[model samples]
Target: MTRVVELVEHAPAVGVALPDAVGRALAAGDIVDAVPDPYVPGHWSLRAGSKVGAVAVATPGNDEPITVRVTPKVPITRLFFLLGYNLDPKGGWRDGEVDVTGHRDLLPALAHAVERQVDRALRQGLLQGYQRREETSLVVRGRIREADQIRRRFGATLPVEVEYDEFTTDIAENRLLRAAVERLLRLPGVPHDVRRRLLHQRARLVDVAVIVRGHPLPVWQSSRLNSRYQHALHLARVVLENASVEHAPGALRVDGFLFDMNKLFEDFVTVALREACRSFGHSARLQDPHHLDEASAIRMKPDLVLYGPSSAPCAVVDAKYKAEKREGFPDADLYQMLAYCTALGLREGHLVYAKGNAPHAAHRVRHAGIVIHQHALDLDQEPSGLLSEVDRVAAQLVNTPRV
Candidate 1:
């Protein structure tokens, strides 16, 4: 029997495990550690600093292995929405068929979303009818292959290489889609229905398209005739470029497949805060890089910087993922933000963290005459509520002095 352990980001799950199979699997996955309890004797719990949204399968030597999945404490669906927009603003969850409701595993959910997007695109058309230069033998027109005319198939057919506009299922777009679906099919724990859909979609694609493994697909532009595939093409590119496989003796570990929650959080906050500040005559600049030293070798990159309509700095914000224990012991984030403020000649700055204990904190430098306001954006709230928090940050910047 296999056991399933689910954990939230920055949270731990504690349980007792059998020594032989389960214990080894936990060790392999880095999901659990041995804990000695006076009452419970031998116990195991989650690792100290596992990444959020990372799912690992722990395989014991012989028996069925346990699966451990970690989800963000903030509503997982909201994070996906953020990721969808960040990846492509015009393409997002609400407009597409990406349904994550009641999803047990984020990886499989992403795969299903990708499959659905490709499936939807195919419905518009089989993505064929593209003219490609072909080299083959024919009885009639096309450039004849004189070498093949006498050497091979002399009297049967003409060997020719010609460019013809024809309707065939073999094309690069279909091949790339086919490759991505095939890759997803190999992943373990995909939903049964999703697997069936993947299989069905793969069959619809022409089989002869060459599978160029480990090569990035070229980006193709869409015209008025094939404009329907622009969104689907972007989704397919993201999935194919990011998804990969890992194999072992008796197990397959699907690694390097996850949405980076930290980046997602930063992008969401910056975009929202920027939009909010627009009403107040301030535009937010993201990742504003400046030379910190006279030599121009040292550079400081602030996550976000607000500028007035006149093009002057208003406030600087640094988004930190953990902003707490997980960020390590040193107070590095504060030091970095201070550098940003000093470089930009601003007296006030802001630091935003994902909500944790002590939701709001303020710090004032004694001699430097600078202020750092720290606020936590509560992720557990609804999207509207979360944006309202950003609204507060934007409002604070409006009143900030230009000094």
Candidate 2:
């Protein structure tokens, strides 16, 4: 699909009316009932009668413009906007506008554009959370002694002179080391060999050092060979300084150094899904504390559950960040998801893996007459390509006939 970008304005009160303008401009089929945001007090909700896709209303900022960009399931000529303006305090009025500016077909282009904006905003929000955690204060103490003398003494003697200087008290340093590592790992365009080497060597060392330091570590490197990785790590470190983990309740310990790979994968998937949903003119709501039942009396909580297009359950995607994909689907995974599907009454589920593997053919399995389709998402792909791939899969689900 060609990329789309859109910008529009609507009154907060009349924002709900913009959907109709979108439906008309895009010619999105039928008005399946609209669903409002249970969280937001006054938000818009509109569903196409044909169940093509969904749209979400973003929270407004201080006197900021209220706008939504719609990317359609199908390509269309012009992007339409149902703008709402506050005509009076009691209520507001909405009107539709078409942008025919500069050889740009507003509809689909605007859709992609709006999605990118929303995705950027959402990512910023997530990064902000990470930033907050990173901004934690680290108790650091420094003493001004002759650097050459200290180095010479340390170099010559096993036991170096140690002195506690009252003048240089403990200073709380803010460093974002972990966030830098994560950003480097997720950065696109870095060569695979380079990434692999960093992951195996530098990344592992940094992870260990972070544990040892009990605070974000400083990166001291002049080599151009791994500059990209180094730069990313630097940024991640900055983010880590503000992250919640930096201010963890207890004194940081080495044992707590164990990084939660699963949680990292989950966060990555959430970002991916948020971007994907935005591209489809829909917003995704994460269903937490997802309940699942199994015959073995063991309950499993999948990483994330997403609701798209009104309240309709769209997809269940699980994230697996392993060193490599196991040969042939793991039996345990299948069994576990089988139970999850049955419990949730879902016909299909997805398993997203971080490392790139030969794309697995979609599988169809039947349990109690419920056919569950399983697929794998390759995280190794370029960010834009990966998001586009997600869009394709979502469109297939929306258009394909269900068994």
Candidate 3:
């Protein structure tokens, strides 16, 4: 049996007698901060940051593995909603689509949801498409490579270098699905039933090529032909990108799937605001880069920059997720927004933050005429309410008078 240690996000550090090898592995993993307690011998103080998920590390001499699970401040359902909306704003994840009702942890919920989506995607049978192939064959096929055939097989006409398109089910879409399945299978703590279903899904994709570790995933374009795969592919991407796998020294292995709520909040704010304000005939850019100095050396990236029809930046916005629940807006954020306004030649800027103790407030720089507004978004609400808050912010952003 494995020993479990549960920690809540942004909670106070607690001392636990963790194995030296496990402590070193967790430190290297950066999933959480583990420090040797000075007062307590053979104990390490563990603290969870904004990241939340489970990480398991195998001890050297112990047969049972020790798992560290960090619970997110937001409910799992809301977290999934944020993840789903970020992955696909246009019908990628709906309320009833991937049911995560009974799941108490992130991994099981994510695994179960992915299996469901993949199963639905392959119900119509594996999608077949044309794949480009280049090889050396004894018999001439589609077209022989002229230069290669002469250079390599000089005076020999047996094996020819040829290139052709092969129609098969082993395409990028199926390959991505297979890769996600394989990833989940390797992870620990997946429910028995979910694992069984994932195996069945893998069997269906037996013909697809397995994605090599650390290699770039096969790319697929969205088209009417591949429309059925869009949902599964997006979710699959989340798994491949966010999960971490590390091999420590002394035969210690660490496997984890974590989500940085700060990044998630920023993504949701920027994406949702863009979509909410799209109907206003203006466009929004996420992580829009700009130079702060005349030398073009100093660079800055604002979370979102809205442009008017004339292609001029009309408004600037930044997203801040406060894990500390502090009382006021961080002065650094206001100064940063002020710099953005000065560089972009905008009079008003916006800072959107997760709901904190400080309510909506506006501050005007004394020397500069720029005014910065801080807006709070409550994550505990329903999807509709969260997006409604975004719409409110968007309206204010659009209505800011132009210079």
The deviation in Å at residue 331 for candidate 3 is 2.8
lDDT of 1 at 368: 88
- For model 2, how many clashes? 36
Q: 309-347, model 2: which lDDT tens digit per residue?
A: 666555555655442325656555666656666666677
lDDT of 1 by residue, 19-89 (tens): 44444544554444534444654556554233443333445363564455566665657666666666654
How does residue 114 of candidate 1 score in lDDT? 76
List the pairs of residues colliding in candidate 3. Answer: none
Model 1 lDDT-worst window of ten:
245-254
Model 2 C-alpha lDDT versus the unseen true structure: 0.37
Give lDDT per model, in order.
Answer: 0.66, 0.37, 0.87
Candidate 3 lDDT over residue span 49-122, tens digit each = 88887878886677899889888878789988998899889776865888897888888998999999999899
Question: Model 2 off-target regions past 4 Å?
Answer: 1-266, 285-287, 294-299, 322-330, 354-358, 378-381, 396-403
- Clashing pairs for predicted structure model 1, backbone only: none
Please state the error at residue 292 of candidate 3 in Å: 0.4
Model 3, position 117, has a per-residue lDDT of: 91
Quote the positional error of residue 65 for candidate 3 in Å. 1.3
